[model samples]
Target: MNRSSCAIVYNGNLGSEKFLIQVRWLERTAREHGLHVQVIGNQELIPGIVDGSPVIKGRYEGQEPDFFLFWDKDIRLARHLEKMGFPLYNRASCIELCDDKIRTYEQLLNEGLRLPKTLIAPLIYETCEGIDERPYETIVQELGFPMVVKEAFGSFGEQVHLVRGWEELLPLVHRLKHRPHLFQELVKSSYGRDIRLQVVGDKVVAAMMRKSEHDFRANVTAGGRMAPYEPSEREREVAVTCARLLGADFAGVDLLFGEDGEPYVCEVNSNAHFKNIHDCTGVDVAARMLEHIMSKER
Candidate 1:
């Protein structure tokens, strides 16, 4: 039996305890599955053009893994690796779509998925001075008071904000105006709560309901509690469809509830942290991900 080899790529600078745990589990699971795995950081492996050919600076000589399990938002390296004929899980484009909130919602809306009303801020370059007050008033009029503001690229709900009225909205907007952000009507029914469904391949392997008593955002990193959840047929279909639409091998699809308990696509995470889901549901998402990779390699 020949063991498959995998290169797990991550961001060294963001090696939080939670992130490292995922990598450790992947290695342990790989060994259990009769596989060889090497952990590499995006900073260590520099992707660039050398002699007019794509090359990774820190890759060992004559060393190429059977596949790359990319766990970082470093799309450049992921793209370079894919361009060099290395199989990448989730693919670079999928990761990019998931990393940018605006892009994710755009794709979901195009597919006619239910989502909260949103307004994307205009793009302003760093070289420019700033945006006018006209758009802010327009956003306030459209989304009204108590809206959600989010930076296009962020994780763990850190970049998401809940603005109550003009006072809070203006300062927040001024601060984030230079950055890529969006305004969304708050899903009041789903306030302080949401569902996270872990999709591996075509299946929703694990799921949990996240709720925060003091916060509107339901991410565990944002002080939300997690509980095991059994999704309904509609929820399951919506999650699977979101993952498929994003061309992801696996993803964490969040569903927000409407007044009538209907599900709305919140956000899709391509390299979603599996530690919280594993702790809540006792499902080894890392092992399942490795299994999916093995199957694909075969």
Candidate 2:
């Protein structure tokens, strides 16, 4: 197989310092491996007119690249790229299934994996009206207190909230009544720490222990600190299984230890950030990922 040129799709409008660093790192790795890499934003690649209408005829005038490296922010454009027959690192089907928290939990559950007890409420008028009409006490009695409410699709620990009691939960639910959310049994025994494992193909390339001293969330983007840690055999097995089940060529599996001292999958990300993983493990994850792409070509 000929060496393929890689096009990285990221949100070019984003001015985050971390994003810049990651783009530079990816560019350096791709160049070092003797592969051509170009980074471009979605808007730039798909041009639009003054009224924010896409110039369909003029857009994407150039031929599509051999392979596409889709970063997180540009994930919504995966299906469009798929229609163009582009080879995305993590394919559109994989991204669609893995991006939805509710669907991801369902898939893991159907596979008979140990996961936190979860319940999902769809964004429907009937469900919303029923919850609003019912007594708050009745709702708490069924789901219990100290549960977690999360948006069906969210990342970077932005939409996850722990409700200690009825007072905290009722208002939140009422506010988010219009949006789809899932209730997960809180794993308090884990002590606000979780393991993040990066899986590329069938291998676990890097792992880290993320901990928060003051909060229940352990995402590094949520002010959590990352440290070197080896996952237990069971943890690795489950993480790898989740990644494979999601059909992700590359993924990040977030595992939280339950009160029963078992690792439960919290979520799976299709476009996982590798900066923390590389920093914590000193593993060239990006390079290894590119190597995986090359090997697949062969």
Candidate 3:
């Protein structure tokens, strides 16, 4: 703790160039606050068991920083750092829960938060040949065709699908049976639209309404356009509460409009990409995040 230093654990498996840019922004922002930051990929440190205890291989051999700014969804590495007593922003549990869409909905629902009716898909091991379509009948009957099928672990709406017919669904289910997923009733009111609220330290710092006329997913990464939107008092309340409930130091909370115009939790991003927000709102989210982390360090 003598020198201000942080390690941003990022995912090396992801090849997105934007991830690299995110690291650069974070490093530059941390410097603004006089904190030295290093970007470390998960692959750099191999996890192993030593004497029947989980330990990071060669963890002590390297420069152990005072803080961990986890930018990856590698829960095991985050947990290992936590066990090593390094302060981690957002924490491993929160990142894990937020990484899995099904878990996020479940946890939020259990917290008495409103969400679109969602059904978890049955688990299918990768070793299994495939899955039967019988159980999907309940899914079809409950949510109907044109429902949303979201993979448990995904980002930027890449693994999210809009099943418009039974024919399209069976193959998707068969293809994704081995992976965890969920079916959610389509929020028609929010179809091709949603809101992204960036929450930090009890404040909704930036808000945007993402809309896509050509696609169902409103993610800017999904070709949606973002416009600065003023959230209603209730929207702000929901977004802030969602972040607090997840124990997130900062997060991008997506909210959907229910049929009755009520806001429901759509998803939470522990490592939310703020480049789009900066483009639209002209707000430097990286600076704010760095400031929030520095506050915790103090």
Candidate 4:
């Protein structure tokens, strides 16, 4: 029995508590399954010189692996790995496309999936003209009183803001104007909860319901609690569709139950965290991911 070799590309030192936990689990699971695994940081492989020589020259020296698991935060390095003949899970384009909220929305819409009414604008800055032309009052009148303001490239619920009225929207718009934001209709009736369906190789490996008690965003990282939940037939279909549409080998589809009681995809995460889903569902997501890798190798 030949053991498969794997490498996980990530930036764990950047305080990704969730990612660290998942990677540790992946390492343990892989070892237990008779696989060799190595964890490499993205920052350690950036354009730099080691001992006054090009870093890339000997960076991967004597380190050839069978599969490359390019996790979150190392998305930018996927393309480089492609040239090395290593199979990257989710691929670079999928990670890049799914990371941008606006792009993900557009792709989902193109697939004829239901999502929130969204408006994306250029980054806001003090010197930018027409900043006030699109006032908060105008946005509220168009979208509604309660809305969501999200940074174009934010993750882990760090850059999501719920605007209840004009007063809140104005300050938030002004603050995030220079940083590329999107205004979306808030799914108020959903009660600050959403479904996360984890897909690996066209199969729904694990699913969970995340509900935030205090915040509108229901990300597990945003102080949300997770519970095991079986996805509806529609949810499973759309979750698989979203991953396929984005060409992701593995992904997490976030679907919110709307006021109309229908599931609307909010976003797709190419390198989604699996620890919470695993804990909530007892699915052994890391082991499933390793199994997928091994099968692909075969």
Q: Who wins the TM-score comparison? A: 1
Candidate 4 residue-pair clash tally: 4
Q: After superposition, how far is residue 44 of candidate 1 from its true place, in Å?
A: 1.6
- The true-versus-predicted C-alpha distance at residue 6 of model 2, in Å, is 1.4
Q: Candidate 3, which segments miss by more than 4 Å at Cα?
A: 49-55, 58-62
TM-score each candidate: 0.96, 0.88, 0.94, 0.88
C-alpha RMSD in Å of predicted model 3 compared with the true structure:
1.8
Q: Specify the poorest-scoring 10-residue window by lDDT in model 4.
A: 53-62
Candidate 4: tens digits of C-alpha lDDT, residues 30-129: 7887777788777655543457543343465546788777875455467766755668886888988898888888777767688888887655556765
- Model 2 spans > 4 angstroms off: 1-3, 47-60, 73-76, 125-139
Ranking by TM-score: 1, 3, 2, 4
Q: Any runs in candidate 4 off by more than 4 Å, and if so which?
A: 1-3, 15-17, 47-55, 123-130, 135-138
Q: Candidate 2 lDDT, tens digit per residue, 222-274? A: 88999998888888888899989888898889998876767888899987888
Please report the TM-score between candidate 2 and the true structure: 0.88
Clashing residue pairs, candidate 3? none
Write the number of the candidate with greater lDDT, choosing between 1 and 3.
Answer: 1
